[model samples]
Target: MAMRKFLINFNYLNNYKNQAVRFLTTASTLSKNSEVLNETATELVKSIVEEYENKGKMFTLPWVDQHAINSALYPFKELLNLGIQPEFLEDACLHEEKLFRSMIKNGQSIYKMLTIFVENFIMNYEDSIRMFAKWCDLLENETPQSIQSRINLFSGRGLASGIGLRRIFEKCPELLFGSEVQKMDICLEQISNFFESGDLKTIVNNTPHICLLDPTELESKYEYIYFHMGFVSEELAKSKCWMDLDLFSIIDRHSLLLKTGKYFYPDPKRPQLKKENPSPELIFDTPENKFANLVAEVEYEEWLIFRELCEQQRRLEDKQEPYEKIKPSQRKAFERRLKEKRENMEGEIE
Candidate 1:
């Protein structure tokens, strides 16, 4: 009976020891988690303060689940290694798995660019997924090198190239996914005719997506600008202010100048219709109100008149029978007929 009792007491002691160890381990784990969460909260509050100051739209890691944090500490370390500011680091750590998978699919260069793209915006999990989806869609049938090259080209040209590659794609999807890159080439050639020297390279530098227009439609707009308004190729090229103007917009806006005698050529020597005499940037680069105040009174007034003229011009263009652009050959034919009529009149007089 004594030996059996001793064995039972030994067994009880062993079980107690095991329970004590487990309890200590559990307590240690909880303490570590509490520490991590507290730190995360402190950093998040600091980031929120920075956001209020406009330092950046601060994004903090979510600690609501607590389970994700215990899953792995490597993501938190990875976020640190990336040299991302604390403002963005926590959320980045939280989404580390998703970000890593996306990087694998998109390649490092594109992935890095995307991170830069979203670094400025404050986004939630869903926003991140949607942006990621957009990137995946853009990556289809497009090489990273090609996208980088275009980005470099636009950036070098002094345009808002770095605003975001996705933004540029959003505005003009055809440049990437469209089947007809050749059509844009034709558009460029047609638009080139309006420039005196037709420095298409320069034009592209100024406005990268201008070639998205249809060639013939761009042609009609250019003809009206040149012949009807008396703007020379070099003058138009110099300003490029009207590059994005719709059909008859130039005429409609500038007509007020002709009507009011405020119209004057940008060039003093070869006088024609008024020119903004500034970079093409003045039209789209600056805020309308800001740019308007800086330009000539006539230019500002012309801008104000544009909204009214736009509807009128659209109505007239709509009324035309199958609206065809008159080619140079057709213009020449009309000129020849006029000359023949003049000769016959001279003969009748004799």
Candidate 2:
């Protein structure tokens, strides 16, 4: 028993000595490598300065020290290896100095960042540079876990994956920068409830900016289009411009179409009535001039005048005063003018 105890102690001491020796060797190697890295960093900075001077361009870089330069070495090398041009890096240092410095200071890996965008998202080098500042800000502000959560949010869902996700991130890169997972989830849930699975996919894939809108606002628009206008999920999905229109614009345009006898809400009991009604695309997808001339069959001037009237009415409503009560005479005159315009429009149509 005594011999066995002694042997165990002897083995443990031997292992400890081996570990200490390896640690010392590693420290010595790192010290030598760090000196080389610092020298390379110094030459890089000097070259950048010389290039700016030769070009007679104003250059700005964040205050860098031996530590900052040392921190930046690995990222700089990684960026170069990832096919980022030296000029692009120099431009980024000059134009986005603070962001570039912050990214290095935070120990964010440039290689991993490029890999996420280039490999996972399939963005090209040009696309990455176009959004370089935003990418840096996103990496600087968000944790790896938070960014991964957002990635999962987009990737896990069938509505947005692969090409769909690439489209979304390309359009709205800011979506990954904030603590908006809860809000985004709620918006997506609301959209899914209102739309069929295929329609939801089309809507999100076409208009990724919809993800940035307030959940309540999106729900309100859906309700108005679905319940009030009698537009189905498929119709709403096909009309890609509808979500871009404000609620008031939609309301006023639809009301004008109703007054002009050009649009009717879908009613199952009256199948024949649906035949003459303009499609949602014709109504919502067109500009004021085209919508007025083609769908409403009214003059563009008339539509402009009506839009102004709608704005005034909305302002009065917000002030808790009805237009009829606040300016009854003016409202009557305006209605008379509108009636005359409609009658003239009818005459021209006939």
Candidate 3:
């Protein structure tokens, strides 16, 4: 006897004859306690019934016998002959061992990606599946976005790359899973490490060189690009603003610096030298630099707040009003307070 696959949709009944045989005959193999599995089965049954009764489509051959149809449908129905719920069928149908086995064999990551693709397209379950199937077809040869891609997206730094990986993940958790999104700094940290370790040699060799610049400044102002563009000539190029500098390292860096000149650092440690054609290796290789950034932002904020409070107290003291200069101990206490406040208002405890 051949195994059967349940034809969850009418289209599948028409499109995938062999797969349909496997679907129904294969049986559900979900765990009894699995909510996703239970929901999937419930949703499938509901969709099937809705498509058949409401649409008035005639299912031939295997679906012809009303008695067999009723019996087949019985497993999905909740009530029992004795007016008691037939718990066994529910467990057996939804938890069908073979079904779960097949699903596992096909790989869950694809399904997870499908879930996200569906949300991105704002599609229903069946439609989502179809869309994802198509998406996979298009992306079959494309590489999935990496953590660096995600960080760049969140930072709003990779605008022209069309790298919406993070957005897709956020709106579709079913497609992507990671602790990194919850703690974006983690992604940054990982990237930092990769660069710190120089493991990104290949990546650097391949991508535009200017990606090495600090993302914060790149995001803040566009002048940085022009500042560097001055390297090419005194007459700065008109800021097309829309230009995807990623294509030209010289253009991207020069334009970004020109746009945000004040923020651009002549980091004394790595002062700019005459470019006789820079190497791609100048780009930082660490996968992420988020943790260091998280640290800097927190400390910087604390410094700003403390400095403000000190100035306020100093002004009162200058008037002989008994305000004391903040001591090291007091500063430490205030720093802790500011750290907690920032974290509570934003993210991650550390």
TM-scores, each model vs. reference: 0.42, 0.66, 0.23
lDDT of each: 0.48, 0.66, 0.33
Residues 1-350, candidate 2: write the lDDT tens digits: 32233334334433444465453557665564444334433444445555566669544445456565555566655554344545556566666655455545654454455556665566775465455565676667666567667767767777676556778776777777774888887888878888999898888778777877877767667666665566788888988788788877888888899889876655556676678887778878999899999988999999999989989878776854221221324644544554566568769989
How accurate locally is residue 277 in candidate 2, as Cα lDDT from 0 to 100? 80
Q: Give residue 304's error in model 1 in angstroms.
A: 7.4
Which scores higher on lDDT, 2 or 3? 2
The candidate, 1 or 2, that scores higher on lDDT is 2
Looking at model 1, residue 163 earns an lDDT score of: 41
Reference-based TM-score, model 3: 0.23
lDDT of 2: 0.66
TM-score of 1: 0.42
Q: For residues 288-336, what per-residue lDDT tens digits would candidate 3 score against the true structure?
A: 1321133222244443454466557657767542222344356545445
